[model samples]
Target: MTAPEDHDYDVIISGASVAGSAAAIMLARRGARVALLERRSDPAAHKVLCTHYLQPCSYPVLDELGLVPALEKAGAVRNEARWYTRWGWIEPKAAPSGPELPYAYNIRRSTLDPMIRSHASGTPGVDLLAGHAVTGVIREAGRTVGVHATGPDGPTELRARLVVGADGKDSPVARFAGIPAKSHENERFSYFAHFRNLPLRDGITHSWFLEPDVAYAMPNDDGVTVVAVIPDKKRLPAFREDLEGAYLDFVRALPDGPAIDAAERITKITGTVNYPLHSRRAGAPGVALIGDAALTSDPLWGVGVGWALQSAQWLAEAVAPALTGRGDVDRALTAYARRHRRGLAGHQHLAADYAKARPFNPFERLMFSAAARDAGMARHMHLFASRIIGPLRFLNPVALARASAVNLRHRGGPSPAPVHLPHPTP
Candidate 1:
C-alpha cells in the first residue's frame, strides 16, 4: 500500500478526530496512502465540553463505515430531538431506519472518538500517527504539497498530493495556507455537566429555547445525561459567582422539574466563554479543510458532530478520483470547496444570526405557535430543527400559508380551548 516510492503519502490529514479519521478511513479503504495525525497519543481521551449528539443525517456514513452495529452494541441511541419552542414542545416522531438513513447515535466522545480512530488505524494503507502535531503546511509554488510536523521522534515531513486540515477551529493547516476564517462576536456562553441516572423524555434529547437562554438535556450512552445551559452574556456574572448553583438552578427551573432535579451530576461543571463561531474558505491549491477547520456554527443546535462526518464524506467523494491518480488534484479541491459552500453557506448565515442571542422574531413565533397545533406543521419544523433541511425551505411561502391557516382555525375556537394535534401520520 506504499505510494509507489514517489509521494510519501496520498493524503496527510492533520487531525485524528472525527473529520480526519473519517477521511483517512475512507481514502485508505479506496487504496490511497494516508497519514492520520493526532496530537494526543492516548486513544481513549474524550472532548469534555461537547453535547455529543450525532444527527440522523450522518447515519448513512456511519453505516458505510460498518460502525452502525458496533455503535449500537456500545450503547449509541437512535437520536431524535425535542424543541421546547415558545408555543410548546415540538416533538416529531423518531426517524425510522430505512434503506438510506439507518439511525442517529448518542454516545460520549470518549467512546465514539476512539472507536472511529481505531477503525481508521486498522484500515490498510493508513498510517495512524497518534502523537504527531502538524507545525505547518509545506508549500510548493504556492500549492500545498506536504506538512512539517513534530512527533514523538522530534520532527518529520510527510509529503502528499494533498494535505487536509481536519484540525478544529484554530487549524494550523488553514492558517499556514492563509485561508481567512470569518467569525462573529459571540454574545453568549455555555456550561454543561454529565449526570447519571437522569430519566430521559421518551429517550429523546430536549432543547428549551428559553428567551435569550437555551438549555438542553441529551441522553448519552452508559446511562449518562449531558445537561447544558447557554445564557446571554448578561448572565455570565451570576454563573461566574456560583458555577454549580447557577447551573443547577437553570436546569431545575425548566417548566417542569426535569430529571436533573433528581439525578446527581457525576462530572465537574465545565464551561467556556469563547465558544468559536466561524468558517474558512475550505480549500487551497493542493489542500482542503474539513470539519471545524472549514466551518463551525452555533453549538446550541448541536450540528457540529454530524457536519464533521458529512464534510469528510463530501471531501472524499469530491477528491477520490484525484487521490487514486485519475483526475486533476486542483480540480478536485475546487469541487470540494464548491460543495462546501453549496451545502453550508445558507445554514451558516442563519446560525450566525441566532448566535446574536436575540429573542424569537416574528417568523419563529409564527412557525413555533402554528407547529404545536398541527401534526404536519410540527413534522416539517422538526426537519429544520434536525438539520434535515434549511431555514429557507422550512419557511417557504407554502409553509407560511399553512401556518396562517392553522392560526385561523385556532382563532375560530372560543377563548383558548385545548387544541390537540391530530394523530401523527405515518
Candidate 2:
C-alpha cells in the first residue's frame, strides 16, 4: 500500500452524511481546514429507508446554516404531527401550558442528503473526498492523529489533530478507537417505503399507536409518502418471508385513518429485520462520534435526524475552543462527551424504556388515555411527543398528581391496576 505524504487538516471527518456534512459546513465557515471523506462515490446518494422528518426546532439550525431556502426550493413541506392513539388524535396544545414549539417538517432523505452534501462540497475551507473507504484510524502515543483510507489512487493517509467518526450506526472509527458503548436491545423490526399517488390529509405527519404495534405516515415533497411499520421482533420472520404483504397488512391494521386509506403502494415494500435500537457514549482520545454512531435512539419517536444535527451542533460548540487554540484537545473531547451524555441521558433512557414491549407506565397510560378522551389533553401530549416539552415538564409532581387523580376517579377508587399490553414479538 502506497501511503501519501502526511497531510495535516484541522479536522478529518469520516462519513459525509448529515452530521458530518453539517459539522464540515459549520467548521469550514469558521475558517477551519477540513477534509470530509465518504465511502460512496456518489455524494448525492440517499438512504432509502429513513423517514426524513425534520422537527420544527431543527429549522433554526438549518436557517443558521443558510439551508432553509435551499431545502424549501427543493420542495420540502412544513408539517405538524397528528398522533393517533387509542385515546384520540392529539393536537398541538396552546402555550403557557404546552411545549415551546409545536410543528415540524417532512422531507425525503433522497432530497435532503444530496442538498446537504452539495452545500458541504462547496463550502470554503472544506475538501470533499468521495469514494474513499477508511481502513483504520492512525494513533500515536495513545492519541488519535489521523486516518488510513483507500481511494481510487490506492491507500492514502490523511493526518489531522482531530479525527471525527461521523459514520452511521456501525462505525468503524468508533470500534477502532475502543470507545465502550452501552447498549439496550429492543425487540422490534421496521418495514418502510416511499409511496406516491397517496391522498394525504393536509401536510401533517401521522403516527398510530395501535396498542402493541406502531406505524407512522410522513407526507413529504413531490407527493411522496413514507410509511414505516415497527412491530415486535418475533413477527419479523413472517414479515420477511412476505415483505410486501406484511407491510400492507401492518398499515391496513392501524386504526382506520385517511392517510392510510389514501396511500397507494407505488414502490416496493422494504423491511429491516430485527432492527436493534441502542445508544452509545461516543468519545475517547482524539476521536468522537456523532449521529447514529454516537447514539441510535428508538426511531418510533422520529428523533434520529433531529438528534443527529443537534449532536453535531453540540460537538462543534464544544470543540470550538480547542480547535481555536484555547483548551487541551483531549480535555475538550472529554467535556464534549460529558455534555452529550448529560443532555441526552434522560431522553435516551425514556426512549429505551418505551422501546420495550412492556406494560405502559401509569403516566403514559393516563396521559394517552386522556388524550383519547379530550382534545385539550391530546394537545398536551403532542407537545411532549414533539419534544417541545421535556419529560420532566410533563412528568412533574403537579402533572403526575393530576393524572393520577384522574385515573383514580375513573377507577372509582385510589387503587387501579396497570394496563397490560402484548410484548412486541422477538
Candidate 3:
C-alpha cells in the first residue's frame, strides 16, 4: 500500500533488531512502506549480552519469515533442553510431531542479528536507516504520528501512520509515549561466557535448578558453548571481588556439572549485575511496543529471541489491515495489545515470581518430581518450558491429577540419590 500524502511511510519501526527487523520484513511483504531505524551505523552490529536461544514455539514464525533455511545454513544448532532438579533429570523423548516441533536453535546473536537485518534491508518497501537514533515522538492531535531522530546526515522527522517501538527494555519510544513499564525486581544477577571444546550430547541445553541459584550450559553453532550462572544476590560480594573465580567455581561445584576446566574460554566473562524484569502497555495511540520493549521477562528461561520473533509477527498481523486502510488503526492496536497480554501475561508473572530467587514452591516440586518419574509428565514439562503452552494449560486438572498419581506411586520408594552441592571451587 502507498503511504498517505502527508506520511513518509506507512509504518516506522524503531530499533532494527530482531523484533523491529522482523516486523519490517513482514509488513513489507504485505506491501506497506516501512522505515526500520537503527542507532548503530554498522550493518553487522550485534547484541553481545544475550542468551540467543530460540524456543520451539518460535519455530513457526521463523519458518513463516523464511529465516529457518538461512539460519540452518549458517550453522544454527537445533536443541532440546535437559533439566536437572533435586528430583532427578527431566529429559523427555524427542517430540513426535514432525520435523520442526522437536527442537529450537541456539545461534549466536553475532550471526542472528545481521542475518535478519539483512533480510529486512533487502526487502522491497523497507528503508533500513542505520545510524538513526530516535530522540522524541511526533504527536499531533494527541496521537503519535511519527518520530524525531538524528541520523548520520542530520536531525530529521519521519512521519508515518503508525510508529512501533521495538527498542528493547527502557524504551525511549515507550517513555516518550507515556507508556510506563511495571517492573518486577529480579533478585538474581547473571554472568556468562563462551567456551570451545565444551561438548554436550546432541547439543541439548542443560539447565540445573539449584534451589535459590541456577546454572545452564547452551551449545551454540561452530562448537561454541555458553555457560552461565544466575546466582542469588547474597553472593554478589564474592562475585564482585573475583568474577571469573566465582563463576568458574560456581559451575564446577554443581552436582555432575560440565567439564568447564577442560574447555577453553573463548570470550571474556561478562553479564548484567542487575536486570529487572519489565512489562509495558503494548501500545498507545499510533505507537506499539514489541520484544523487550513490550516485556522483559527473566532470562533464565531463554525466551527473549523467541518472544521477539513471535511478537513481531503478532504486531504485523494485527495492524496490517489498518495499514492497508481496511480497518481502524486504534482498534487494530487494541487487538494486538489484548492478544499479547493474553498470550504472555501468565508466563511473565510466573517468570517474575521465580526471579525472586526463592526455593521451589510445592507446585513446582510436585511437577518437577513427577516429570522425573514419568515420561508423559516430562513431555508436559518440556512443553511448558519451551513456551509452547501457557501456565493455565500446563496446570490443567488432567496434568495435575497425573502428577499427583506419579508422586503417589513413588512415595514409598527410595528418594532420588542426594546430590552433594559444594561451594565455589577454590
Candidate 4:
C-alpha cells in the first residue's frame, strides 16, 4: 500500500488558493510531501468576484491551520445574518448550539487568498510552485499517476501518488481527467460594489429574500461594506441599459437597507451575468477534485468559501493515512468523496433549487413566516442558514410540526402579501 518511491510527491494539488493551499498545509502537517501548484505568478493575486463570506463550518479548519488569528489580525469581521422576509425580519437572538452568537467571518478574498497561499508556501514538505499550470494529467494503466504542467521553467511533468484538482468552476484538471460536470443554469444575475463609511452595524449582515430576487449588505474588513443585488434574469435588460443606475436603485429600494446614498463608493460595480451550478464526481482513479472542481452551487447561500475550506480539510484527513502507507490510497480517496457527498448533498440540492429564481414554495413560506414570529423557529433557521447544521436536521419532522403550529395560531386573519419593489421600465 506504500506510495511509489520514485514519485516526486505523495500529493500534487493544482490551484493553490483556498482549497489547494489548505490541502497542502494539512497534508504536509501529516508528514506527506505536497506540491502546491498555482498558475498565477504574482503572490498577491486574489479572486475579486467573490462573496468573501465564510460560514462557521469552516472555522475549525482555519483554527487547525493556525490561520484564524492571522485572519482576525488582518481585519476579518464576525457577522450573524439577519434575513428580511415578507413576514418580517427573522433574527435569532441566540445561537441554538450554544450561548455564543451565531456568526460567520467576512474578509475580502483579495486579502484571504494570498494569506493562506503564503502559509502553504512556508509549510515544511510543501513545494509551492507558483506559475505552474496543470495542462493535463499523467495516466498510466488506467490510473492518474501525475500531471503535465507549464511553469516558468517551461513544460514539466511531475509524478505523484495522487493528483488533486482544487481549481475553480471551469476546472481544467477535471476536464483532462474526463470527469464531466452536471450543470444547472441559474436564472439570476448579480451586481455588487464595495463602499466606505456606510452606517451599517458591525457584527450583523443583512439579507432580503425578496421572493425571486435577493440582496445583502455585508460588512467586512477596514470599514469596507459589500452591497449586492441578485435579481431575476427578467431585470437583466434594465441592468444592461443602465448598470450603475439600476444597481443603485435596487439597493436603495431594499426594505430598511443600507444608507448607500451617503456612503462613498470605493470600487466599480462588479457583475456576474451567469454563474451556473455544477456538480461532478468527487474523484476518478487516483485523481480527486476538491472545492469548486467537485461542486459549484448557488452563491446566493454564500457557501463557496466555506465549502472550499471544509472540503480541503475532509480530503486531507481522509487521504493522509493512506499517503503515509497505512492503507489503500484509492480506497481512502473514495471514502473522502463519500464523506463530502454525505455532508453537503442536501445543502446543494436546496441551493440549486432556489437558484432557479422560483417563488418560495409552501414549505419555505411556512418556515420563513413562522421564524419571523417565533424565537425558537428563528434560531433553528439561523442554524441552518449559517451552515452549522445540515438540511435533514433543519427540516426534521419536529421542526416542521412546530412551524405548522406556529402558522395555525396566526390563522385568525388573512396573511399579508410579500412586498415587491417596482422595477423600472427598460
lDDT of each: 0.82, 0.75, 0.90, 0.90
Q: What tens-digit string does per-residue lDDT give for candidate 2 at 203-263?
A: 5677877655678888888888888888777677767577766666667656655445555
- The local distance difference test score of model 1 is 0.82
In candidate 4, the residue pairs with backbone N, CA or C atoms under 3 Å apart (3 or more residues apart, or in different chains) clash, namely none
User: Model 4: what TM-score?
Assistant: 0.97
Predict model 2's lDDT versus the native. Answer: 0.75
Q: Looking at candidate 3, what is the lDDT of residue 212?
A: 83
Return the lDDT, model 3, position 216: 93
Q: Give candidate 2 regions above 4 Å deviation.
A: 1-7, 93-100, 259-263, 373-379, 405-426
| Residue clash pairs of candidate 1 | none
lDDT of 1 by residue, 1-426 (tens): 224356798899999988899989888888789999998899885566677988877877888788998898999877777777556677665345523322487889989998999999999999999889999888878888899999999999889888999999888899988999999867779998998888876877888887777888888899888889888887787778888878777777775436676787898999898786889988889889999999988888888888889899999988888789656888988989999898888889888888888887778778887887787787777677667777789889999999989878888554432222121112
Task: In candidate 2, list every pair of residues with a backbone clash.
Answer: 87-372, 88-372, 233-425, 234-425, 234-426
Candidate 3 clash total? 0
Across residues 161-247, which tens digit of lDDT does each residue of candidate 4 receive?
Answer: 899999999999999999999988999999999999886754478999998999999999887999889999999999999998899
For residues 31-64, what per-residue lDDT tens digits would candidate 3 score against the true structure?
Answer: 7899999999998899899998998889988998
Better of 1 and 4 by lDDT: 4
- Tally clashing residue pairs in candidate 1: 0
